[model samples]
Target: MKKITLSLSMLALILSIGMNEASAQKIKINTKGIGAAEKGLKAATFSDADAAKLAGEAVAWMDANNPVAGPNDPYTKRLNKIFGKHKNEGGLALNYKVYKVKDINAFACADGSVRVFSSLMDIMSDEELLGIIGHEIGHVANKDSRDAVRSAYKREALMDAASSQSGVVNTLTESQLGKFANALLDSKYNRKQESEADDYSYTFMKSHNYKVTALASAFQKFADMEKASGDNRTKTEKMMSSHPESAVRAAKILEKAKKDGLAAL
Candidate 1:
């Protein structure tokens, strides 16, 4: 009995050490300190291969700066379960990580990395979360992620990063990675791309037999939250600034729901 007790204690100590080591590796990024490599860098076009390379660099930089929740974390486990159920149609293999951040945001990269903010998960239902995730996947399927990467990095810098792999393309330095990472955070999708992604998400839900109405509900929820902010940011201004307005998107989704006779429409 004493030997068995000793073994159990040893196992517990090992697990505690492992947990501490993992926690030590997690970092908090000072978003303000990170700046773009070049101001007003002219947008450049890139091949699919080049976009993939940039995506790798950006992911590395982000992983270093952001505190990523581990697989053992409940949030990470939940996200994995939800994401795992979906079979992505895009060519890129999708992988997800949960960032322990307060901001309510999520993003997908050209390399098919989806990082979800913990705050977003806190407020959204599983179905609503699926809708938002579907929208992000749509961006990847439509190659919008690749385009975003291209717009963030200069042609010369991207080419350099790509070539560095084979000694043919110039390689990206750690500093360069930081700049690209910052640019990615600041990257904006045009209205056209946003609309396209929305359409893709709708189709994805319809195909998967998920609740179509949930999409509308998610948008309405965001709209309500924005309104509650009680700031000068009107719904229209907010929509036009980047993504479509929540009310407008919610209306569009409801229209589709009604046409399909989905769930109490």
Candidate 2:
């Protein structure tokens, strides 16, 4: 239940999307206070290029550290078959890969690095998987991923870089990159951002002429998982969850689907 914000469900890695319940890795949030340089740097000063560059570095470090599915692996095959042609999805050129992990989650990085976990694939249908991944992509396209990296960049550029004289993100060491990844994943998306990501998932399906209902169904699956997990959060605990309940998100999608004649309510 760390501050990981995911799309369809909480993923342990808490990539751009977090696992609501998946607990493969528990990345402790950096509790260190911002330095004078980080405090002086305005969050608004970060450009889209800075976001992408930082994301690229962090994702590269993660890719090298984690076990990636090979080209001929079933996970990779499935992802490529479904998403290869859409490399330029959402106007961003995306690189897709599958992580051979047990965590049921997927995430889209700011640089359009879309990573899908095999465990998540095992549980979700292709269409449902698409919905979930689309939601993750929504985070990137909507700049949620960018925002997550901005904080990490600010902290790392100030802490690791010899001088923040250029007033932009600077390179980080391997150790600092690990911190950068953790900070990026620990970021939580507010209710509004989550809703927008859901909307983006819906739009992605609609545009692709895929089953838009899968978006709602995907949420329903998460809702069911939460229920089966015996969720008993108090108001304070629920508020600290960092994202809206899956049931509520499912309901919203169903309402929209019903209105659009895409699904029966």
Candidate 3:
């Protein structure tokens, strides 16, 4: 009886140690994952291969589902011109398309795919449009889109109630795709990133000789729209929910412009 009890106690102690070690390992993995993300951001670079793969997947999904119906000929021409100038400038293969959404928004994916909304172009001048495009391009150059993609994937898994599935994940439904698009558009980037993108836009506009003031003007326009649509939950929520306040963004850009000797237009 004594021998049996001693063996049982030894087994129980071993099991407890094993459980503790497993828990610690999990904690270490979590910490390491977070550390890697932070390092990626600090480095401001992404793996070109990873970006291309993600872009291909995202484009395929968008093509099959949310087909954009805008003036592709003119838009593609404009994009080719802009991107052609920047080709070989960055390591990423930056590509763009104009989606037929009426929403005044634009977004870049981790894989160097940029989607601009038609309504966004309707509201802005050519210079203003360039500013917005430059900003999105900055996100790609900085690997912000890749970081956002990773963040979105994690968030979706955490938020989904039916996350217990094995192996492959299915494509999002149309509604889910819309939700994802909106989320990506309205997602709040870290302040550092926002500032960096702003700086990149300034440099891009300055280098290309586009009106840098358009950056601030774009934000002001968004801010005014937000104010005018007060309490109209949909517009207001869309404007303010995911992004930093337009006023704040405008102010920061203006400050940067002044410092960079870029006068208001």
Candidate 4:
């Protein structure tokens, strides 16, 4: 759920593209440009609140930079229709939106912002998408988002973008926000954390009485996609490479579901 191996488009890592929905502004960021913001990052421990606030700023920048579907758009309408009722799932306040991108991915920020890509919605059924959403939110509910931002700042070698001697979140310049967002995007969760989030996702599905098989089915979809990969290593192929055990993981999920008497097949 941290980066849903389904469609986190490794191409975004290579190209650093951001397509805005409202103004349709496109931003191309390079490592050198990101380095410039290093001048503002002060070394400090990022508190949970600070992490959430920083996440909020980063999400705001991302929402402005990415192609978010409008309220009237089918993607937005469908997400709203299905997830609109559960504003506060797993005791975490949440907001949902659809990004009109071809990438089959979804992510959640520490600030309770969840964005689903239209392509992901296209390939997945409602319950399966819900399972994916649950997994992503699991990352947040378990405070993985909080830890990820901290780790990201450290990995980027720029712990605080707040421009403060003491650590706290504050208004960031657009460029500074971009730097923070990049760091967040580059953050990677460990296998343990990801595994925990997957379990949390199943727990979420159980609590909601949603079809738990969707979780297994979702992973099976990833495995199937990987099998159907092309000769040239596309971005999806790269993503699948990073998560080579998709089919195995899916099998594990199915096994667990069968034990719980929840598997249909």
lDDT of 2 by residue, 154-240 (tens): 665444344455454454455554555566755666778777888888999999999988877777786676666566742222432
Error (Å) of candidate 2 at residue 68 is 0.7
Identify the candidate with maximal TM-score: 2
Shift of residue 242 alpha carbon in model 1, Å: 2.1
Candidate 4: minimum summed lDDT over ten consecutive residues — where? 10-19
| TM-score winner between candidates 1 and 4 | 4
| Candidate ranking (TM-score, best to worst) | 2, 4, 1, 3
Give the number of the best model, judged by lDDT.
2
Candidate 2 wrongly placed segments (more than 4 Å): 1-5, 9-44, 155-177, 231-240
Candidate 2: residue pairs that collide: 5-18, 6-17, 6-18, 9-20, 10-18, 10-19, 10-20, 11-18, 11-19
Off by over 4 Å in 1: 1-45, 155-177, 232-240
Residue 98's lDDT within candidate 3 is 64
Position 93, candidate 3: lDDT: 63
- Model 2 scores worst on lDDT over the 10 consecutive residues at 27-36
Better of 1 and 3 by TM-score: 1
lDDT of each: 0.57, 0.66, 0.49, 0.60
- Residue-level lDDT of model 1, residues 1-265, one tens digit each, is 0000000000011100000011212333333333333233333434676666666655655677677899899898888777786645555588778878644556666777676667668877877777777777776778877776676565335654444444342345556655555555445565566666667667878888888787777677767766676567532223333456667877988897788888555
